[model samples]
Target chain A: MKIEKEPISGQYGKFKIDGIDYRVYWEEAGQGIPLVCLHTAGSDGRQYRALLNDKKILEKFRVIVFDMPWHGKSSPPENAKVGNYKLSTDFYISQIMSFINGLELVKPVVMGCSIGGRIILHLAINFPDKFRALIGLQSAGHLDPYYDISWLHRQDVHGGEVCGGIAYGLMAPTSPESDKFETMWHYMQGGPGIFKGDLFFYKFDGNIGNEIKKIDNSKCPIYLLTGEYDYSATPEETKSLADTIGIEMIKMKNVGHFPMSENPKEFLKYLHPVLNKIS
Target chain B: MFKSLIDDNEKRSQLSIMAQYLNTSFMISTIENEYLVNIEKGVVKNVEEGPFVMPSYVFKLTAPKDEWLKFLKHTPQPGSHDIIAMLRRKVLKFEGDLHPLMSHLLYFKLLLASLRPVENKNEN
Candidate 1:
């Protein structure tokens, strides 16, 4: 039988953040400038699979993706209680820093989407020197809750399917069917209440309205890329954030909330230029 | 038009796997019209146009004709792209029990999305 294997590698390592032991799983491909990609809420590092395998991007950047604890292949902390996964700003920052320090990455360019996108702002404001550049996909200072998240973790509902269903609408209708479904599949596999737990940080704990003003773009240049169809983090929201911070917002057409995963080909078209400028 | 499109066998087969256990009815109301759709075990049994005094449906989704027109476009604008988007923008009103809708969200979402007009390939 003929076999074809991807040019990607996966490894699991132990990281201690805030005195908790987490067996984190990460995937890496390519070489050159270090690029750390953070996935969306309730999803995992698999969101960056298309980016990790792109030949052109691989030629210029060493792309790395890691699943946060309680997500994907990364098991929750051994000593933790069940269904108690709440992400706080300090906890999120410490985890990223620990992961970077553990991997010995020096000033890697940090890029994140959705909740991951919001965290990059916190990172920029708190640890400006840690990253070479900050890229926020579907990022905004705050998001108003649309639907009752109580449905997400309720026993009466199928958490995974409902979660996937909610995210399905966030993609542009023009995106390829296979890619859109794949992005939904990630949400479908999320643990119970995990999406809502992450939202605790997204909707409430992680509001950066006041702190965003402190981020000096000259020191750690901030780039915001928002999909036009992302209702959660609409183009208006990103544009407002950009205007507030005195930076330009790049609006991606025919894309939506989960740009990297839902329409990677379209996303790369917007990304390549930014990476070239960063390089 | 909504009835014939949703009741197609191929369309029913494309619904989410969880639809197999769903047996519910809902109403879709545009500004000037209302259509009551009945589903039993994932199959679209019937769709009836209505001005009934008190129609029986688990839930009702109401949106203006213009909003529905936008939603039915082959590639709708951002805020009109999906039910949730419209709900977020307060353009679509969802009334009645949400349990059935939220429990089988994928099924309902796909069911509604299937109504979008198919693009014409020969357009100049």
Candidate 2:
């Protein structure tokens, strides 16, 4: 006896956040508390498309994922005139705040990867008692060792190709060819300078090492699941942050920055434990 | 021309807010010598011709004096106008972090293009 592949799907909509009408393209499944997922820089909610369709996880939590402005199907804010769409701390927060309020979610669990992971710190630290829990993937209190990829902006080298190439080095060498291409394919669709704009927060604005002290664990429990292959925010870096903030840290092996997208099946093995603990 | 261009608070503020290419500096080098241009939050603080104490820059863009003069002309020829064009043509050589150079492409392009003297066709 054998089972065939199951088709994955999602529901989508649009919502206004911070005076900007963002086209919210998202998927939701199962029942329980809403688990809002944020994506890494350059890429979009598509990064979590796999998780949204996961059966076991879907059964326990209502999964949600949306693309940021200037990413995926979402429209950029009016302030984004030409190549001027920069993401600020206020804007990033407002987007999430508005989304949560818009959907009328009840103390939803916010999970993010990379810049998504980075912004959760700001959300958790500033809002404090707002969200139920924060699951930061490839996150650090302060993301050090940022690689400047400006040279890749030349016409000779396509920005998307360059975007995909840089991320290629970070993923596990043993990852499936299809999975790696799928992850790289998302990056291949990044908007001009969008990657750099996100890094501004990932590297600087979101580097709230000292700010983490302000966070009260009782208000929102923080769980960091960093990828071992993620040099940008390695396990060592996340461990240091966990040790400093006194939160739980899990080192995800054979995966890089985009765990949910890279090896979702293998990633679930590590994620299940954390989800159970929080539940 | 450089002074007035950099002094324009509107442009600087716009660049800072829109691009957030803050606290970044680079050296523009001609065959004659080098000039250190330091910008903080998009405001140009200093532009001094180099060969001095503790000279530093994120990236150094080098070209011959004549080529620069030609590139900075009212209308530069093919492969002489843009920095990337010049680099592609091997007319301009970079000596440092290319990230800032490429990342803040427009700012630097405008900064260099600002060197073009305001043309007054009727002037004798």
Candidate 3:
């Protein structure tokens, strides 16, 4: 019996833009309109590891996954740790654009979770006509009551364990122990102050409350899908956001913030119908 | 270099965004010594020697003097690092009404960690 399966296969490379070198660790398989997958904050594209290998998803989409700068398997920017590594809305959007243009993927349907999900809303408004459609999983107009965990950045604290505890809290209360452990593993490898940096965007810069009205769905349809167990960006929050923006919001049962990773099989139950509508 | 960096007009403006709601004095007592930081509506007016008392202060953060020294270095290790981490491990302590500290957590964190690069500059 093969206990450990072979890792999926894909091309990986590093490219430079505007004098900055970025390591792009990506996987691609099957053929169709490129379905570019973006991960949530402090998490690399491993969130889509299952989808990259899912035969059905591959049959319909060119599934691809890549780590963002300073994230899993990707080298940190030259000055990532110079000071407090804060992320802003413009900077996060720029990174997404770089990924799309750098790979030269044409009209790919962009799907993201958490911070990844929040950015799609901004993408629809700013670039308007770029992506085929934008999907926000566990997304919100903004995340408030942002817990101040800046104290976690110091030298004496256990970075991995503390961050692990925090990450575990956002998952479904009934999540399998193995699933919860795997999720915590991602946060364990997170660079010091990385989660706090991402929250700067998730909590502060990603607030597009009134700006949601400006998203031209005709240019790129905006869809919001959230998990039933996401306390940070609750299903109600996404539902309220969808009602406000006049877009559609779908809730995935038995999942939390990180849908693709938290419960991909169940998430696909909701995902299949949506992808069918888009495709 | 450390002084100039903190007192820089533009960067202070940017960092002040985190502390815009702070309007009180607080002390960061690094064991052997301490620094009393005074602020008004987010702008840091002054930082002076501790054992220096001010009645109108919000709270105080205390850690072993060397702990702060190690932390202010460009890099820190586990056990006594970030304020939250230190607190979790019981190496760092907080006093006075915690409301101010809790309300402006990111502000106080950045304000204190801002001292890290200063230590680096001093070493160079």
TM-score of chain A in every predicted structure: 0.98, 0.92, 0.93
Specify the poorest-scoring 10-residue window by lDDT in model 3 chain A: A145-154
Q: Model 1, residue A249: what's the lDDT? A: 96
Q: Which candidate is the best by TM-score?
A: 1
lDDT of 2 by residue, A1-279 (tens): 697644344555678887657766665676777899999988888888677777777777888887887888877755565456567778888998888898899889999998888788888878877788999899877755334455444554457756776665556644675987789888879888787677777777667857777766778898889776676776877888787778768988777778999888878888888777767
lDDT of 2 by residue, B64-116 (tens): 88878777675554445456556545778877876655555555665676666
lDDT of each: 0.89, 0.74, 0.73
Q: Is the docking of candidate 2 incorrect, acceptable, medium or high quality?
A: incorrect
Model 3 residue runs over 4 Å out of place are: A1-7, A17-19, A79-83, B1-124
Q: Least lDDT summed over 10 consecutive residues: which range in candidate 2 chain A?
A: A144-153
What ranking emerges by TM-score with the best candidate at the front?
1, 3, 2
List model 1 lDDT by residue over A74-158, tens digit each. Answer: 9998877757889898898888999999999999999999998899999989889888899999999998788898888988899
After superposing candidate 1 on the true structure, give the runs of residues whose Cα lies further than 4 Å from its correct spot: B121-124
Runs in model 2 deviating more than 4 A are A1-12, A152-156, B1-124
TM-score of chain A of 2: 0.92
- TM-score of model 1 (CA atoms): 0.96
lDDT of 3 at A71: 77
Position A16, candidate 2: lDDT: 82
lDDT of 1 by residue, B61-113 (tens): 99998888788777788889899999999999989998889999888887877
